[model samples]
Target: MPVVPPPVFALAAGIAQHLLAPDRPAGGARKLASAGIAVAALGLDASAVAAFRRHHTTVNPLDPARASSMVTGGAYRLTRNPMYVGMAGLLTAHAVRRGGWLTPLPAAAFVVLVDRLQIPAEEAAMEANFGEAYARYRARVSRWLPVRA
Candidate 1:
């Protein structure tokens, strides 16, 4: 289990971004893009949660081993870790809204930390629980985003 939930880290990083550059002026384009990204991120989270509920699996990230079944539908088809990706997207949206060179640093750090620490542990537990099925899913889906080229 991860010592800290990914959301906590994301939340802290978001707060840090504002503290670093609270008054950074965002233009209309930035605000629009931020809103779009935030909406997409929220939708991803909702879809992932619904998929887990449909599969009768646990949504608890700290206990992947307790997952009753694998969730391959909805947002899971695009990314193995939609919730984490959503969190990252939200941070990115906040960074864009904040609009400073340094604002994105915290979001970048959140991605690195989640990718390196939280996700690997979850993947291991998932592999242990689902075996070849999860291996196939892992192979089919990207961890955070789908490949375009």
Candidate 2:
């Protein structure tokens, strides 16, 4: 199966969800909250990228086999898939900023797609390459939410 990059899907779905809903301008507190969420999400995304860069591994999600290292430190210590988590966060912020019942639909769809399709394929590739070490990391880190390091 072809994998759609998580960020692209998040962006598309967020916009689609916004378009589907009635206009609801964000209030001052809501705007602040949304911006904070988005900023934090961007930080998570950047942390993942930084980890990849530090490891000199492939950052492209579509080409997992090209990965030179299985990153499991820093942001990886928090969640197994930090990049996807970050994208989900951003989607959530978009949903919050838009303010409608349908807003959350896009974020939900993103979760389903990434969890069911993207993460599985990436995990399998990592397992094929790293074996038990990868399994240990998987056991330690939560897939989506950051709970502990």
Best by lDDT: 1
- Residue range 47-101, candidate 2, lDDT tens digits: 9999999999998888787778889899888888888888989988888888878
Clashing pairs in 1: none
Root-mean-square deviation (CA) per prediction = 1.4, 1.7
Per-residue alpha-carbon lDDT of candidate 1 for residues 70-107, written as tens digits (9 for 90 to 100) = 88887888889899889989999999899888989999
> Model 2, poorest ten-residue lDDT window?
1-10
In Å, residue 38's CA in model 1 sits off its true spot by 0.6
Runs in model 2 lying further than 4 Å from the true structure: 147-149
In candidate 2, the residue pairs with backbone N, CA or C atoms under 3 Å apart (3 or more residues apart, or in different chains) clash, namely none
Please state the error at residue 26 of candidate 2 in Å.
1.3
RMSD of 1: 1.4
